[model samples]
Target: MQSSSELFPVALMSAELRGDLTEDVYRLKPANSPDPSVELVLTRLGRFGQEGGRGVPVILLHGSFSNRRFWYSPRGLGLAPYLARAGFDPWIAEMRGHGLSPRNQQYRRNRVADYARYDLPAIAAFVREQSGQVPHWIGHSLGGTTLAAALGGHYLGEEDVASAALFGSQVSRNYWPLKVPPVEWGGRMLLKRFEVLSGSWLKRGPEDEPIGLALESLRWHGLFGRFGDAERDWWAGLAEVRMPVMAVAAAGDLQDPAWACRKLLEQVPEEHRHFLLLAKDEGFSDDFGHIEMLVSKAAEREVWPLVAHWLEHQRLPLTTAALEAVAL
Candidate 1:
């Protein structure tokens, strides 16, 4: 591994106030990335007067077909800002070709493998250098899955992460059709026709995704499949993860259901593993969907505070009605 300065040359893009909060954007160019031209954009939100998030660094990653905006809006009304207001230094990262991040040389070949192996380490190192404290990571949907891959593959360690919290993320959902050779072959062949999956056309979100990601999923759910690459078995690695972690799922999250999310949580094999299911039965008025669990007004009241509390204290209480095992 290279030093943070040698590996990631950063450019300060902007430092301005969004509402009452200060937003500083930086573009990091890493020399060791598989795709050499890759540039990742990180946005850190802070208060007008506070310094260095009071030594509590938080890194937030968005799901597929989304960007940093998923965690925050330009008007500064989102989880990132909410965390900032609560005296936590929150960094929001955009994936390749999403939001402020520009396309790399092999834009179409970008996969979670590349992100876990090449991108996340640099991001973690950069955050560590900028803030003297190890940061806690938070991810939504694909972001959470990528975080799992990074941790399971040993791309990150206890030195880099204080803890991790995943929202609306899971890998247990089975695509039975992909289990057959013929169906998997046909699906790959059809997906190869396009360089990217159009989020706009699919009405999934605001950004497009490399088809390599789609193809990668086929392999994961295919025959003899596991959640890992050729180099490491991420599923097996999950049991080896030592840091505190949490996985939250929504009852109405059809994309990544509560049952599937719980499966991911169960794999960690940690004594402090926390599982939260946002459902009407859990005291939330709504059985929040995949997107709603993070980006809705309901989440602002019920979910954001829990995240803050989790970062402050490692274990959640086992008695909260709104959370599976919520708050300190």
Candidate 2:
């Protein structure tokens, strides 16, 4: 494994769409897009296993208010390289409004729900066109939630995805009562009022902060944390996903309680569903919060391997009876 500093140079080398990037990284425009065309800013590690062929493509989705850069950050608990080593082509997606995705200069009024309908579907279409198959969807936090919505038929075209691995995602509409500080609650109210006054044309903030810092700020004062009527309608659609799902929860993740995670897993129609919780010693204890499982150093060693192993297992051909037996 490379040191965090070593990884920083690689991450810095990747282009930021309009921003300047270091020498080691170069940006490439993805093929077969009808729109303005998406740019895949990536770092090519050596080929995965033997044969050196392009591996199974996997698209990673980051949590709320975070960009694709979270997957490559030094402290990031990303599984891209590890997946690549395990014979998978790792692709990180920046949702339409979040990362290096082109800003909507046209319809300026965009909301978090728009991501489920637009950005994620666009990414899925792009992946299918380029990779020739529906890639496995891996996401954390709000990213996972949006992906769930997309898989459940909220997105257009209804692509047949292979499977999904969701981390620290919530399925119920009961997230608001989770005991936030008074100041944070006040900040959230202010942001909600601001969004209403602005007609949902609120601009996104900078993207260089730590994942925790970004989500904390959103939790305190951004539309990302506010779940309204639209969000409730969105969650209602998650019951449509019928594919096998690997739902993960960290024992210490207060943002996604274990009970809630189990409840969410029960909603998956797949008999091959599995739920796993990160142990406290894995730094998933009280210190590592919601988004940390994807960006924290501890996740690289602990959480990611479990995700990779589960993905590998799902790729195997199993009869319905065998799968049900395993689920049992």
Candidate 3:
């Protein structure tokens, strides 16, 4: 394989349209990345009828073991499509070894650290190169976690981002089991035996996740461990992020509870920060699960529009503290 240094940053691979929306897929090969075989797939979605003009860019990052389809399906029925129709240019990114992006030479060794440090920056630069504007970012679950890592680590800054929104994303939630040194070491040892976790076997999602991700998580939750690698402390770096930010959590989501999500949001200075808890107690029709919070029919009526509004205004329609208390 040629060193990434020898190749251009991005190459347009294919283009198509879902109904009136145009889909142009590209492969991003970052020069700074350690492995030249790491190819990240990015799809730019054009507006419903405007194929010639580009709108403001919004990049959507899917969760663990997921791909672009998490945001937009083939039938043109998801947030990516909705954002496109709403006069926003949506860019769907598939991380290394997911969706249209093929597994690279170091696929089993891939971790969120690689994503935050290298992959995301390359994707953002490519989008800026094509769109000629800073792009807003939205991420769900692990995707959101990776985005937080990038922001908190200072890999992404105001120069690259118009705004950011995180869905079902948090790191404050503790795994008590991993806090025990023996258990953490044992789990890491067991996970190291596999190259990837089978999503279908686990009945979690469609795509498989690298064992490296699980190992990294174990280290983070191990005794005296924190949410960063040996290089930088991501949790501490979040204080340095000054961009507009929003975090959404589901009351019914046991994976990432609303309080932990709120804690992650609180790490940011309160100036342009927003938070939403999807629960009937909060006036929603039902308590939403982790994935259901964004993909459900109820979300279509209550949540998607709010996200669109946040993208346009860079904040949500938040009630005053007293009003929220009274409503509760």
Leading candidate by lDDT? 1
lDDT of 3 by residue, 181-222 (tens): 888888988898999999889988889998888888888778
Model 1 root-mean-square deviation: 2.6
Q: Candidate 2 on 1-328: residue-level lDDT in tens? A: 2211321211234432211111123233332233334343434332423424766668788775567666655432247756765677677776544455544332234444455655566556555655677778788887777676665545633364677888888755353443456655665555444322221233332432223222333442333443222334434445666667778777778878767777766766657576766655433433456766665666665556556656776642234333323333
**lDDT of candidate 1 over 1-328, digit per residue (tens):** 2223544578888888777788888889876775679999999889887754354999999999999989998777899998998899999999889999998989998899999888888899898888878999999999999999999999999999999998999999988888999999999999999999999999999999999999999889998888999999988888889999999999999999888989888889769589888888877768999998888888888888888888999766566553534421
Candidate 2: count of backbone clashes, pairs at least 3 residues apart or interchain: 1
Q: How many clashes in candidate 3? A: 0
Higher-scoring candidate on TM-score, 1 or 2: 1
Query: What is the Å distance of residue 269 in model 1 from its true position?
Result: 1.6
For candidate 2, give the lDDT: 0.55
Q: Candidate 2 or 3, higher TM-score?
A: 3
> Model 2: runs farther than 4 Å from truth?
1-52, 74-77, 106-108, 154-159, 171-236, 270-272, 281-288, 315-328
- Give lDDT per model, in order: 0.88, 0.55, 0.86
Model 2 RMSD in Å is 10.1
